[model samples]
Target: MIRPDDETKPFVGRWNSLIRILLVESSVKHVARAAMDYANLYDGTSCHPSNERLARETGYNERTVRKAWAAMRGMGLAERVSHGVAHRRLSDEYQLVIPESWQSLPVLGPSGAKFTCVHCEKAFNPTGNCKVHPDGRVTFDLIPMVFCPEPRQRKGREEPWCATEWDGQRRASGETPWSQLGQERWKVFHLARGEEW
Candidate 1:
């Protein structure tokens, strides 16, 4: 959570360049921009805002805010510092790490090139052709939408090309993608494969 004192600090000018880069290159533009705005609200290394608060401030739904937070974390722009614990269920704390070192931002992969899945953080190579699923979903050889965490939500959004699966399963259950299993389940899956999240 941001310290009360940090709320009084004015926005720094150094974030201008970082914001510009995010506007032009980030696939999740609104979320990234909103994150910057939230960061600017305080003078500390972290900020804590509920999804409802973020939605109200950014004009995005809570689901979109959640996705944005996930995207930011996957892109190494922000990190979870502490989980919220309360009867009313407060929001988690997150540290915006990008402004401190924007010079080292990860580069987006070129067209048709192998890249990491921004959501699953796995490598994928696209075949350049999309396969239309029966449900009107589209996927590529390198990264199938079935293996992605938020295929429906990411339908028309610009995203990095990459492939991911449930680690050991070649095909995910149609009704329930492995990503919905939550972080603890994924960690167990990775551990079974001798890997770590």
Candidate 2:
């Protein structure tokens, strides 16, 4: 379901190597690069020419796209999204999915009680992953999301998330990069652990 404008419009006439693939390359990396060029932007979300869509658009063997996509995923150039069981259409191909800053997570201070997430200012009580996408998709906030509803203070003194400072902030010691916190880890940190380190 990658829209034509998805890549073409954003990068705008810069197909570069991919255009070459669209013309005369079939090497996994090259064709995959072509497919990736379809994404054109790395907004921390998966975007691209779905192998199926690419097969339709470029007439390249799905396997070529699949291999290149696999390499891209290995190279950290793209992300496979969660499409539930329905996402199984391509056992080898991975779709680009974005990791949005919404989900279950708690806000902790240097010490003390944690606060809840109130996205768009709706009073969302404790729930799995803390984020409730109206689309039934769950998301978790990353790094307190700058939307942390409360800041750590003395006992019973959680301040607003908007007031927290993020200077020099980093993934907890020995913690995985934020992007690597996939569904399970993300769920635990934000939903289960309530945004704790």
Candidate 3:
């Protein structure tokens, strides 16, 4: 999780990855931006804003805002911490979360040890055409897409997902942007790879 006022490198990196890489829908991105503004001015962990306020801030209709909220929740970016009681006239509160899968990813692009392949022990680039093998041989036929041997799950954290070549192929083929395949499909993809979602 990141606070809206956080200025640290790690926080900023995670924020950049979320807003720039993970979020694909424009409306969802707009709502997320508005939520961040509210989060900075409001409480640190959560923000309470009515749908109308979000709509006004994003220049979107209430329905669009609602859909964006749902999409954000599905993306594991934000979740409602508290629901408003209509009779009491309270507003919903939401807390932004950094998905475990994104924690080890590079802020700008694939970098560091998180992208290293378990098979070749080589660091793979998410958007590249080739990679240097362990024998110091450059392979032009391979795209250097990589994944963890298995899902990395801590005691309480959500399962951390590493990218595979299929993800790169989808991006290369222009089928779907990574992380925008919707929640169910993303889960199925991981589960198919023997990761328990």
Give the TM-scores of the predictions, in the order they appear.
0.41, 0.28, 0.47
- Per-residue lDDT of candidate 3, residues 66-137 (tens digit): 777776666556768899886887778988766665522212232222344433344443332222344433
All candidates' lDDT scores?
0.46, 0.39, 0.54
Minimal lDDT window, size 10, model 3: 104-113
Question: Clashes in candidate 3: how many?
Answer: 0
- Using lDDT, give the best candidate's number: 3
Q: Which wins on lDDT, candidate 1 or candidate 2?
A: 1
Provide the lDDT at 74 for model 1: 57
lDDT of 1 by residue, 1-197 (tens): 22111324344333333444331223345555565665644342567878788788778888877766665665455678888876768778877654343332322221213434434655543222223344433322322311233334366685532234344342544544454555444343222223211
- What does candidate 3 score on TM? 0.47
**TM-score order of candidates, best first?**
3, 1, 2
True-structure Cα RMSD, model 2: 17.3
State the lDDT of candidate 2 residue by residue for 37-127, as single tens digits: 5553543234534566666666667776665555444433346664324355533334433212111212222222343442323233332
Q: Report the Cα lDDT for residue 157, model 1.
A: 82
In TM-score terms, which candidate is top? 3
All candidates: CA RMSD (Å): 13.7, 17.3, 16.3
Badly placed stretches (over 4 Å) of model 1 are 1-12, 23-27, 40-44, 99-197
